[model samples]
Target: MANADDMLKVAAERTGELAAPGMSSRPSRKVAVLACMDVRLDLYAMLGIERGQAHILRNAGGLVTDDVIRSLSASQRLLGTEEVVVIMHEHCGMNGGSDDEFSEALAADGAHPSWRLGAFTDLDATLRAGLERLRTSPELSARDRIRGFVFDPETGSLRDVESD
Candidate 1:
């Protein structure tokens, strides 16, 4: 594979114009999905939605941080999307670590991020925490249908998380 610089150049060279240029900013699914930034997770196939169907907000643990709340507020008020889906997964790297350990690790690299690392003990409980954050967030336009799921990459399926 090419180096990072070459990768961008190669990608640009092979890229084509958008086929759906006139697509609206509003999500077609009327939902916003908060998911882990794990490269293996694909929202399209998991939810069976097409491009421009849903607003996907990805972060390390898919936790509802302040930034996510900010985005979700705008997604509902400005954009035409509603509802929230939190998809955490099995074998997440966020599991089995402490915030202090994560902070110290970053400190060694001369970077001290202020945000919580959101490491957790239980995957299902972590997923539930994210779900509850959306539920309690007053700015979310449609909290009635908030859902959480734990994706099993091994089984290639999702297990529903019971509401808190």
Candidate 2:
């Protein structure tokens, strides 16, 4: 069976165990968190966030892409999120990866895209750049509170990244 099938079976076994019956769609904490899609880091447990408390967005490397900005725009404007937190982690796949290789692979498959793979060599610098992008983006309603961090999966700890 597929992994999704296994997940479905578990969901069936625990139906309503994670349900929030009366919780509002808006985040109670009025914050939005963007993080890498790393299985080792559980955002809820790491950040002490519960369901309906904050908006959590995840993607490769947790770099601030255009799509992330778009989501943040809606998160702050429509969902009332006033703070933003970005978390990239140590040993991320995107770290030390090659965008050229990724693009060439896509080209071999006869695909062409406008966006480049956000690969970075320096974790802290990348985090700082992403934080700066968030801070300068007029689309985000609350920019002053935007912060970035680098998670150490080995130690299960997060180190703050200073932005310009």
Candidate 3:
């Protein structure tokens, strides 16, 4: 298990020097990727992107929500991002349950979230829905640049998903 002391060491090492300085303030790839906050998934390495290359937004399932829309709205309209890619994966934590049920369980465990959990019964549907959500959000500026994919956790492969 990770400890607070180890985290402080990591932070100290990180702040000691710039990992990849001299890159532009804007992402070099000019893209933003919405991905799940999976421990096994390395967003930059898996996508062949580097630090300062793309903006990555991560959450439980990488499901599009009002908060995501707010961040992306600024990423595009303010930060010069031109592309959006959503990456959902198999065997996700958000699968296999209803949001209401999950919330109830959380409440029992003494944790309560007022926000929507964005749970889904179908992975592919959720993936496509995230793409469409970004495309249709009136707050986002680059609607045409949005797309979605499903990642295979076992094989570390991403399959293109139809965002109809």
Candidate 4:
């Protein structure tokens, strides 16, 4: 696990070099990308997008949860983003995981949350479902350009997912 103090120290040291001058809050590409919070998946390099090119939203499993919808709505309506890219991946931790067991574990710790683990066995199907959800959602102002993909970290390959 990374130490917060150490991370902060490093960030403070590099803060001067990390400045992005004259970059607007709005994405230059007018797109929002929702991808897994996996350490190996470098969205900027993988998607060939720069820091100011797209709004990047990351979560476990890359599932299209309510919060993701909220962010997407804001990205499209407020941030001038018109397209969305959903990227699920091969060998995800969510694959074949048990949500009920996870919930029970949380309950054992005396912490009960309303959210599910968003686990799924099929990566392509899950991506397609998330894409469909986004496409049909009334919350997002721009749904026509939404696309989904499956990334293989081992092979460094990104494959497009077709909605069923």
Q: Give lDDT tens digits, candidate 1, residues 81-102.
A: 7788888888788888799987
Expressed as tens digits, the lDDT of each residue in 45-108 for candidate 3 is 8889987888999999988988889989898888899899998889898888688987888899
Q: After superposition, which runs of candidate 2 have C-alpha atoms over 4 Å from their true positions?
A: none
State the displacement of the C-alpha of residue 28, model 1, in Å, after optimal TM-score superposition.
1.5
lDDT of 3 at 84: 95
Give the lowest summed-lDDT range of ten residues in model 4: 155-164
Higher-scoring candidate on TM-score, 1 or 4 = 4
Clashing pairs in 3: none
Worst 10 residues of 3 by lDDT: 16-25
The predicted structure with the larger lDDT, 1 or 4, is 4
* lDDT for each residue of candidate 2 in 46-67, tens digit (9 for 90 to 100): 9999988999999999989999
Give candidate 1's TM-score. Answer: 0.88
Q: lDDT (CA) for every model shown?
A: 0.85, 0.92, 0.85, 0.93
Residue 63, candidate 3: alpha-carbon lDDT: 87
Q: TM-score of every model?
A: 0.88, 0.94, 0.88, 0.94
